[model samples]
Target: MTKTIKTVSFAAAAILVVIICTFLIIRQTHENVLSKETVVKKVEASYEGKVTKATQSKDKKTYDITLENPKGTYFVKADAISADILSMNRVKAVNPSAMTEKEAEHLALERVPGTVKKQTRQSQVATYTIQKEDGKTYEVKVDMQAKTVLSADQISSKDQQKTPITKKEAKTIAERKTGGTADDADLEESEGTLIFEVDVDLPDNKEATVKINAYTGKVANIVYED
Candidate 1:
C-alpha cells in the first residue's frame, strides 16, 4: 500500500509539470500575436482622437483608421513600418472609395493612353504618372468615387493650360510674327490663364517666345531671350 501511494504521487507530479509547460508555451504565443488595439492606441496618441474605428487589410497587412468624426478619418499605408497619413502631399481634393485600382487604371489609360509609369493613391484619389512618347511627363488624377478623371496636369509646371489653338497653328503664327522657325510649341499656363507658347529661333540668332490666348486664339504676349 505504501509503494502504490508513492507511485501515484510521482505520476501526479509529472502530469502537473507537463500542464505547466504547455500553459507557458501557449501564453508566450499569445503575447507574440500582433494586436490591433495596441496599434490604435499608438495612433490615438499622435492624432488626439479616440480611434472609434480601426481596420486591417485583408492580408493582415496594415490598418485603416477612423475617428468619431467623418472628416477626421484617415488611412494607413500597408507595410512593415505602418505609417498613417493625415494629409497627403500635393494631392487635390477628390472623393475616396470611388473605384477599384483596375478601374482607375483603365480610366487613366483611356484618358492619357501613354506609358503607365506609376500608379499610387494620393489622399483619396487614384493618381497616375504617365510618360508620353514625346518625352513629356503628366500627372492624372482620378476620383474613384466620382468615377471620373478630376484633373490632368504637366508635373513640372502648373503654368500651362489647354489651348484651342493647335501646336502647328501656334508654331506657324510664331514663325510668321518673328520671321523665325519654331524650336518647340506647347500649351502653358501664364498668370491666371492658359496660353499657347511657341519658341522660335530667328536668323539673327535670337530666341523668342510667342504667347497666344488659349480661348480667344489671339496673340497674348511675347518675350525675347536676351
Candidate 2:
C-alpha cells in the first residue's frame, strides 16, 4: 500500500513540472511576436521633408531623397513598409516664399549680370557676391520660389558715373580689361564708375568675402568673416 502511494505522488509531481514548462514556452513565444509587430508598424509611417528627387533602390526596398536649402540628402529603407507623402519638393512647410537652391541660383544669374563671384543659399534665398572685370563688387539677392530678383546693388565705392549702364555692356567691358574671365565679375551701378571685385579669403580663416564694382566689372575687396 505504501509503495502504491509513493508511485502516485511521483506521477503527480511529473505532471506539474510539464505544465509549468509548457506555460513558460508559450509566454516567451507571444512576447517575441508582439515585439516584431511593433517594429513593423513604425517602419510604415511616412517621413516628410524637402524632396528634390526620389529614386527607389534596385531592390525596391529603399528610397533616397535630396533636400534643398542646406543641400542635404538622405536614404530611407522602405521594404515591407508604407508611407504617405503630404507634399513633395517643397522647401518649407507653410511659407511658399521658401525657395530651393537651384531656383535661387537661376534667379541670381538672370538678375545680377556679372559672373557669380560667390553664391550661397540661405533660408531659401540665393545671396550672390559678384565681381566685374572693371574692379567692382556687388551684392545681389534672388528669391528662388518667386523667381524674382530681390536686390541688386554695387558695393560702396568712390567712382560716380551716372550714365545708365546696361548689365550686358558692363560685363563685356569688365571682362576684357580685367585680364580675367568674365565669369568672375558682378557688373552693377555704384557711385558712378563701373567696378569689379573678386572673392578674397582673409588670413585668419578659409572663409571668403566677395568684392565687386556696382557700375563696372571690377573686383576691389573681399573680406572674409567667420
Candidate 3:
C-alpha cells in the first residue's frame, strides 16, 4: 500500500510542474504581443503610404488600418501577434469626372430649394445635406459623373417656429467665437434643435466649421480641418 501511494504522489507532482511551465510560457508570450504602433509601422513600411487611421479589433487579435496615398485609400487587416497582413483592399480612388463641390452645391440647391447645411464627400460619393425654409432637412445624393440628383430624402423635420436669432447674428457670433473670417452661414436643424452652420477661415490656411444654437446664440461645436 505504501509503495502504491508514493507512485501516485509522484505522478501528481509531475502534472503540477507541467501546468506551471505552460502558464509561464503563456505569460511571456502575452507580454511580447505586438502593439498597435508597431503593427501600423509594419503596414506602412510594406504598403508605402500614410496611415490615416488604425483600430484594433474588440478581441484584440487583429488591426484595421486605413492608408492613403497617391494610388488611393486602402484598408488593411493585419495579425496582432505576428504583424502579418491578412488582407488588403482599396476603398476609394479619385474620380476624374466627378463634379466639383460648387457644382454639386448649385445642383442640390436647384433641386431642393434650400440652404446647404453640410457636405459628405468621399472620392466619388457625394452628398449634400440641405435645410429648406419649412424646417425640413433633406439629404441629396448626386451622381458623380452625370451631375444629376440621384435621390433626395427628408431626414428630419423640426417644429415650425420663428428663430429668435437672425442669420447675420449667427455669422457674427461664429466669427467672434473663432476669431476667423466667416465665409458662409446656414440655418439648419440638428436633432430637433435649430442651429446655424458657419464656415470660417483662419489666418494660417486652417478652416473651421462652427455650429451655433439658433435660438440662444450659443456656440454648440467647432471642428477644425487642415
Candidate 4:
C-alpha cells in the first residue's frame, strides 16, 4: 500500500479500537440495573397512579415513566448507570417544590460535613445520609414542599479497625444474613472499639442494621428497624 493509504488505514483501525473500548467499559461498568417493570411498579406505588406510558432507554439501562393520577400527569426518568446507582432523574410536571438529588446534596452539604451516601424519597419527603470523618453517619430529611431540611440526626457510626474483612465482604455477609441488598455501609470507631455497620434493606420492605466486628469479621449484633 502507498504511504498515505497505510496512514489512513492505521487511523481508522485506531478509531475502531477506541470505540470498542468505550463500549466495553460502559458495559462492564453497568452490567446490572433495576428492571423497568420493577421501577414502574415502585413509581406507581409511590405516585398512587397508573403508569400509562413507559419507555426504556435505547441502552436498556434507564427508563422514562409517565404516571397519570387524579392530580395530573407526571414524568420521571430513572437513571440506571454506573456503580448500580438507582435514582430518579429529571422529574417534571409533578411537585414543583421537590428537589433533585443534586439539589438535595447541595442543601445537605451546606449544613453538614461529609459525603452523601444514599438518597430516597418517601411520603413526599426526601431522606438522605452523610458520612462524616468521625465515623458517624447522619440521616437528614428534607421536606418536598418547602425544600428545607426537616431533621438531621446522627444515626450510626463506629470505630472500625483496619481488619480481617473488607467492607465489600462485610456487605456480602450482611446481605446473606438479611436476604436483602446493602447500602450506607460504614466502618468507623466508637470510643475505643472498631466495627462495621451495614444497612441491609430486605426484600419485604424491612430494614435491618447489622454490626460486624472489624477485627473478627463476625456479627457483633443485629437489629431490625420498626
Candidate 5:
C-alpha cells in the first residue's frame, strides 16, 4: 500500500510539470506571431528610414524589407518569431551622377515652356506644375537621374476638380509643421480614407513623413526619423 501511494504521487507531479511546460510553449508561440504592421514599424525603427518594400518568407517565419533614405538603399531581414535583426546590408548608394533639382527644372521648362508653380520629387522623377503666361497650367515629369523629359500634359479644367487639398498644399503644411524641405508627395488610401503623404528632409540627415487627411486637410500622422 505504501509503494502504490508513492507511485501515484510521482505520476501526478510529472503530469503537473508537463502541463506547465505545454502552457509556456503555447504562450510563446502566440506572442511571437507579430502582425505585419508591427513588423514594419520595427523595421523602420531599426533602419531609421522608409520601408519601400516588404515581403515575408514562405513559412511566414521571416520578413525582408527594403529601406531607402538620402544615404542609400538597404536590404533588411528579421526573424518573425523573435523579431530579431537577422541581417542588414546596404544595396545601393545615392547616385552621384543624378541631376540636380535645378537641372531637372531646366529640362521640365524646356518641355513645357512655362513658369514652375510647384515642383516635387517622387522616386527618380521630378514633377513640375508649370503655368503659362496665358494662365494655362501643365504638368511635366522629368527623369532626374537620366536628365530626360518623361511627359508634359496640359492640366484640364476637369483635372482641377481635385480633393479638398492639393499635393502642393500638403507639402506646405508638412514643411511648416516640421521646418524641413518637403521632398516627395503622394496620395494614398489607408483604411478606406484618402491621405496625402509628404516626405520631408530635415537637417542632420533626419527625415519626417507627414500624412494629412484629404477631406479635411488635417494632419493625420507624422513619422520622424533620426
Candidate 6:
C-alpha cells in the first residue's frame, strides 16, 4: 500500500511539472506571434499617404515636397526629416500624417534659401509658396503648421523662343547694355522680345542670375535661381 501511494504521488508531481512547462511554452509562443504581427501591421500602416510631386533646388541643396489628400493638399521639408528619409526614393514613401504642415514648411525652408511668401488655407488643407532671393520659387501644401509638405512644386518660367540675330545686330545690342553679354542673349517665346539671362556668380558658388526681356529687355526678374 505504502509503495503504491508513493508511486501515485510521484506520477501526480510529474504531471504537474509537465503542465506548467506546457503553459509557459504556449504563453511564450503567443507572445512571439503577437510581437511579429504588430511589427508587420505597423510597417503596412506606414505607407498610407500618397506623394504627388517633389523637386530639389538647382544646387541640390534644398528639397521641395508636395502631397495630395482627399481633403486637399500638404507639404513637407526633406531636411526636417532624417537625411535617410530625404532621398528621392524615400520621399516618395513618406507618410504626411506623421508630421504637421508648419513642421514640413520649416524643414524645407531650412534647407533652402527662402521664406514662405504666402499661405492660403482652403477647406481641409493649406498651400504655401516660398520666394527666395534669386527669383527661385517653391509651392507647398499642408494641412496644419506641423510643417509636413503634402505636395511641392518648384516655380520656373517656361523657356522663351529664340529669334534670329545677325552678329552685327548682336554686337550692337551688347554694346548698348551695361554688364551684358551677347552670349547670354536669346529670343523670347513671344518672338516680339529678346530674353537675356544675366549671370552673377556669387562667392558661395551660388549664382544670382536674372532674366531680362532683351528686346524690351526690361529686367523681368532681379533674381533667377530656379
Question: TM-scores for all candidates?
Answer: 0.28, 0.27, 0.36, 0.30, 0.34, 0.23
lDDT of 5 by residue, 172-219 (tens): 999999899999999999998889999999976899999998766789
Model 3 C-alpha lDDT per residue in residues 85-183, reported as the tens digit of each score: 999999998555668888888988888999886677776658887889997878888876877898988873342133346678788888899899999
Q: What would the TM-score be for candidate 1 when compared with the true structure?
A: 0.28
User: What TM-score does structure 6 among the candidates reach?
Assistant: 0.23
Q: Between 4 and 5, whose lDDT is larger? A: 5
Which candidate gets the maximum TM-score versus the true structure? Answer: 3
Per-residue lDDT of model 2, residues 1-226, tens digit only: 9999999999999999999998897666444332323323443334433444545545333444444433333433333233323223433434355567766766666665667756666765777877667867777888776778889888766432332234454445444443333344444445765554443333454444344555433545644446
Residue 39 in model 4: lDDT: 72
lDDT score of residue 30 within candidate 6: 48
Which stretch of 10 consecutive residues in model 4 shows the poorest summed lDDT? 156-165
Q: State the lDDT at 65 in candidate 5.
A: 81
Kindly report which residue stretches of model 5 are placed more than 4 angstroms away from their true locations once superposed: 1-96, 163-226
Model 6, residue 131: distance off in Å is 1.3
For model 5, state the Cα shift of residue 110 in Å.
1.8
- Show pairs that collide, candidate 5: none
- Name the lDDT value of residue 56 in candidate 5: 83
Q: What total of clashing residue pairs does each candidate reach?
A: 5, 46, 0, 8, 0, 38
Which stretch of 10 consecutive residues in model 5 shows the poorest summed lDDT? 157-166
Q: Give the TM-score comparing model 4 with the true structure, all chains together.
A: 0.30
